[model samples]
Target: LTRYDRMMARRRPKKGQAASKGYREAKKWRAKTYAKIARQRQDTGRKWAKKAVTDHDAIAVEDFRPKFLARSSMARKAADAAIGATKKALVEMGRKHGRDIRLVHPAHTTMDCASCGARTKHALPLSERTYTCTACKVVSPRDKNSARVMLVRAGLNPAGVEGVRPPGALLPEAA
Candidate 1:
């Protein structure tokens, strides 16, 4: 919401007759503010990502493209999240070590019943944090459930039994 307000206020293109030296100055100020916010978010993401990759031998996270989210109504908020920055930082950090960074598929990660393995349509509003499945009665944090689905995609069962690792489970092996 703030990002949208900020972006709108800052990036409005000048119209004919409304354009003036003063108006140009105001636009520049707003643009600068928006850019500053973006940089701050990216900086924070980079710091956290660096820590995760440095500390953990293996990191499992949802594999998502920020561009797809950018096309949504929540574009501004998604941009503010700096997902690309974090992933970039993690990849570089992981490369420095002999570690792996996993980005599991996001499909049905949240809606699929982790207990019964039944897929169902889950249309939980973004405001809702709790996920209550109607079919299998699996209840858990929305993000955690998604993570569990991702783990399953990587062939790791909910009970923690290891299996064949999924593609991209680790950083690409050196040729």
Candidate 2:
């Protein structure tokens, strides 16, 4: 896509000049390719969302804009992954199924421990794939811990592999 973008820019006519037939064809091809990729992303997102909503009764998603990723070195990779699109699909699917969907704040998610509910003093770098809590000595994968944090912040169950909440747990009564 980047290569095609460059090619299209080069083929574009100068000021007051008409677009040549070859340039028009190239522009059409680029649009077609981009649309195809978008359709592919939508297809995969819907399928994944369906499976996720079917398997879980509740979901807690990190509420954050993915646009900032475009400024980082992983911009191209992040855009190709289509995380925002997939997340939108997931939320829509969850709503359609009448499942609980919570959007939790993303701050300090990776620094917090799932088991101990403790946060580290400093944020961990991306290279550090594991989270170790000094307060309770609980060690978990960074992504896994962040997921638990989201669940916790969303007031959902943060434990049990089968997505079951602890026995006798109840929601706080509204004031």
Candidate 3:
């Protein structure tokens, strides 16, 4: 799309001149592609949100500010992911199904130790995929630890237990 935009810019008419047929066609194509991608993202977001609502009685998610995140170098990727749209869909699905959808503050959820409730002094960069608690010497996967923290904040597990699920707990057969 960028390449096409550049190509059309050169072919487009100068001041006071009408746009060329090729430029018009390129503009049309760009609009069509943009609409197509928007529709696709909306469809995907709704589908995933519906499935999550169907599978779980309650959903806990971080109340993320995507616009703030998009101001960084990850702007394009964050915009493409459409996190806000997904959240909206999830909330709508939750209301329809009478399921709980809790959006908790995201601060410290990732850096804090889920087991000991201790916050790491130093920031954990994205390159670090595992979280090691300095106080308790407990190690946990980064994403899982954050999820557990969110669940705890939502009061889903008041005991603050970690890794207590039975084997194959999420498997369909276990249901």
Candidates in order, TM-scores: namely 0.61, 0.80, 0.76
Worst 10 residues of 3 by lDDT: 160-169
> Would you list the rank order by TM-score, best first?
2, 3, 1
Model 2 spans > 4 angstroms off:
68-81, 160-175
lDDT of 2 at 117: 79
How many residue pairs clash per model?
0, 0, 0
| TM-score of candidate 1 relative to the true fold | 0.61
Q: TM-score: which is higher, 1 or 2?
A: 2
Residue 84 error, candidate 3, Å: 2.7
Identify the runs in model 1 with alpha carbons over 4 angstroms from their true place. Answer: 1-19, 67-81, 125-141, 155-175
Which clashing pairs does model 2 show? Answer: none
**Cα-based lDDT for every prediction:** 0.66, 0.81, 0.81
Q: Pick by TM-score: which candidate is best? A: 2
Model 1: number of backbone collisions = 0
Across 1-175, the per-residue lDDT of candidate 3 in tens digits comes to 5666776887888999889998898888888876887788789889999888877777898887665554565456647368877888898889999999999887898898878889999889999999999999999899988888888888788353453454434755656
